[model samples]
Target chain A: MMIKLETKSLREAYGLCLVELGKRNKNVVVLEADLGKSTRTVLFKEAFPDRFFEMGIAEQNMASTAAGFALAGKIPFYNSFAVFASGRAFDQIRNSICIPKLKVRICGSSCGLSDFGDGKTHQSVEDVAILRAIPNMTILSPADAVETVMMMEAMLDVDGPVYIRINRNDLPIVTPENEPYKIGKIWELRKGKDIAVFATGYMVKKALEAAEELSREGIEVRVLNVSTIKPLDTKAVISHSKGVKGIVTVEEHSVIGGLGSAIAEALRKEAHPPIEFIGIQDKFGTSAKNYEELLEAYGLTSKAIADAVRGMAGR
Target chain B: MEAEKVKELKKVALKLRSNVLEMVGVGKAGHLGGSSSLAEITAVLYFHKMRLNPKDPKDPKRDRFLLSKGHAVLIQYAALVELGYFPREELKKVKTLEGLLQGHPDMKTPGIEAVTGSLGQGLSIANGMALALRLEKNPARVYVIMGDGELSEGQLWEAAMASANFKVDNLVGIVDYNRIQATGPIKEVFDTGDIPAKWKSFGWHVIEIDGHDIPQIAKALDEAETVKGKPTVIIAHTVKGKGFSFAENSAAYHNAALTEELYKQAQEELRKQGELL
Candidate 1:
């Protein structure tokens, strides 16, 4: 039942989705902090010049300015690197955006190890840990380009603040086209009873790959994409993982506060089960030749997930 | 321009100062030093310059005022109540739990264009409103009041540069350069050397004026409107805690409340200022 889908970068989908949204609603405004080329908001700026704003190298100002636009009845989407958008402007986003519950959608690009060439400063490995503590903030980490578009559309209907972390590299489009995506909902891609492989963002692809590898060895594995990191759907996570022997959470982010921590927090009061975490382990990333090398160095590949799955299932 | 009108604006300024004393004195914990510094600036706008209506605070054509230095929200609250944006009785409950007035300015209250208190963020929001209005070809102007100490935030510099680059001529920024910070003088705590030149280098039309003077404040605002193709910033030299002699230029009064005896004494001095105006 595998569908042959084209591979495209999430940033490409993010840019095109904004262009489409700009056409759909004139109230849709895009603001970029001197990263239109990398963030791909240039597509939106080229399409709708009037609605696009070039804020220039100021992430904090860009966030608060977006809040002003939101207050003036415009849906503003501001973008920058995850490290800057979520880290440097943490206070601005908390007070100016989240405290007032302004409808400013913050898209943090080059998340985790995605910006491998630029090194640790560009790669944001702990954005979820930093943002989840803020009140009235919704966090979404899309798995692929298609889901990125769907989440962008979903945020327009939402009234409060929403942060979506986008990957840098192109990934395979795994989700079925035209599939409805909602905030705080899980998408069960492959079902099995032996062990659950919970993943998010780029790691969802890694989890699916690990599931196929485990399937060849007669160890049935279940894979779930928890896109909405905040307001974790504990019910779906627990129900789908009821009879599984163990669980291994995979993410492109840090193991402390990303998908692994979310799953652990959800299963806190549940029955006996061992949970394994796979991500950047409580440390900074390094400048690498490619993202693949960084992933392998950080133990964030499909083989790492597969090994964790087998170890958790006591194989 | 008229002497009688200047007297009236001064009267509003004195009354607003008294109201800040009453509200913050009742609230027992409010920003007195910075709030006092912004009294004349807020009065010059609400009473003389800005085009607004108490009945229709959200009128699209109305000029906007944002208090970026949100800790001094009592001054703005006094002006809003004077304009009848809300009931005068609400002033008595300032900063109380579940009160209409909070420690900082919030959009929940009418006439508050944006929620601000976190310093160095208001100018950017004001610039954003200017951008939106410019796109609509609307002639509405946006005014933001920022503290001198608030300029320590890097966001303010970024916003200043962006607003000028965008040619947001309809936006005006007024700095209450009261020469003091929350702890001490701005020079001792992250001083921004020569603010007027700093703003000028950012491509803004800069003006220096006595902040407490009514006619000068009004005339500066008018002059700002005539300058085309760029935003304008008025650097007003003001004293922290102007009216009361004991609180003047005292950092201890930055957030400290006055005692009952001192409160009555300050009220007497303020009543004299009111009568003189």
Candidate 2:
């Protein structure tokens, strides 16, 4: 499949989705924790001021309020940093949202290495891992701007609690705007027999790039963009890894309980292979010059992934 | 709604209290003191105040109740069982795996509005529910019960501020001021001075009452309904344990398994009051 080019930044994509969400449903309420502009919910707030709320810096209260809105028959989309959404307000999310199975969407913007130099405080490399432990939660990480729009639209249909992790930086548009948005379905971008690369969020494009690089070196690398982390496409993973040399899971989160852990769990009791996890190794991140350097330092680059794949393939 | 009904409600409250004691005494792991303290208030809400339908637990028009201090779930569970939300026999299964009644209230169980164990969160969730009801133009009121010790959480103040800002008159909060937390007195753990005055200052309609008095609890609920354009807070002064002289005002009974001798003694006392089943 060819990568489609749709020019839209992450912020702009979020703004567009907010606008669409605002127009499509009156019950749709947007909440921000002092980052309405950063999370790109300002446009929706301007249009639907009555529906949008600025809950100050209290992410915990913001989560509780969103759960409240859901109980009141409204679709509340709460925007906050991934760390605060998953760490600071975790109890609120688990209790108010997940326990009742309220239709609350916690949109965690500025996730993983997206914080760049803001360092460990802003970077949420372990959020996905933590949230996955909670029952009745739908975890999702879209690849790019188009994927973000698709996921935002798709979230309206998902009942119970939905958690979406996003980043601050722009990513290459890897999927076409017209791509069918079927959440929980993995899209196999490239097929090969050497190694199956499972990647999510901003790292999907990198995995595809690594696949291309490995293919030129006489290695058939299958690249899969695992969009929906929860309700994981286990069948896709199994078929994609059929007779493959090994499995390499890549993500922008901690390697502990992120995408790699999910894939490893699925492959553990089955036809398993040499598994390599590409993520932050159980440590806090730092303030870097840019997201690119942060990604490279965290071993999230295409070259790093390619090298890992080469090693797994015994090259 | 009548004198006879009030008498029946009081009887129900006593029965609820007895059921609470039996469950906690059997489980040997529950906030018995707090549960006993809030029994009458729970009865008043379930039996007289709130328009809840056990037959239609999911009735969208039904009132909502959130138990913020969920450690005292035996109180809420006892009331729920008596109200026919679940089998009255299920009360005996408290804290057991087969029982829907977990250590805390769960929404998965019938009549439980939300999952609560962590304190200082119920009021905010209540505020949100009230705000949502107001936004949807729903007439159903949202009620929440909080422990006096739960006021120590800073998030409670945030909820207080948000409730006033939203002007959620449909929300009613009741604080069971039993004057005891887990270890000891609430004053030692945290000082949230002047509970009623604090809520009043936050723009809420404040009512204080003897929580064990059914008529007083009823009057306070009636007064809260009249306070327009703002939410209401009822401060019920209650003993840690009531009806049982041995456990009354005793923090050690906060959670204690009643031995066979103690259970028999408590049962005899409850039977004399015509409360024991």
Per-prediction TM-score, please? 0.95, 0.93
Judged by TM-score, which candidate is best? Answer: 1
lDDT, candidate 1, B1-277, per-residue tens? 8999988888888889888998877328778888888888999899889999789988988999998999999999989999999998888888877579889988789998887988889998998888888877889899999999898888999999999889989999999999899999889877789899899899999999999988899899999999999999999999999998988987878998788888898899998987776
Off by more than 4 A, model 1: A1-7
Q: Which ten residues in a row have the lowest lDDT in candidate 2 chain B?
A: B268-277
- Relative to the unseen true structure, what is the C-alpha lDDT of residue B117 in candidate 1, on a scale of 0 to 100? 88
DockQ for every model, please. 0.72, 0.64
For model 2, residues A130-220, the per-residue Cα lDDT tens digits are: 8998999999998988888888777789989998888798888887676677888998888788898999988889998888888889998
- What's the lDDT for residue B91 in model 1? 88
| lDDT for each candidate structure | 0.88, 0.85
Question: What residue pairs clash in candidate 1, if any at all?
Answer: A9-A170
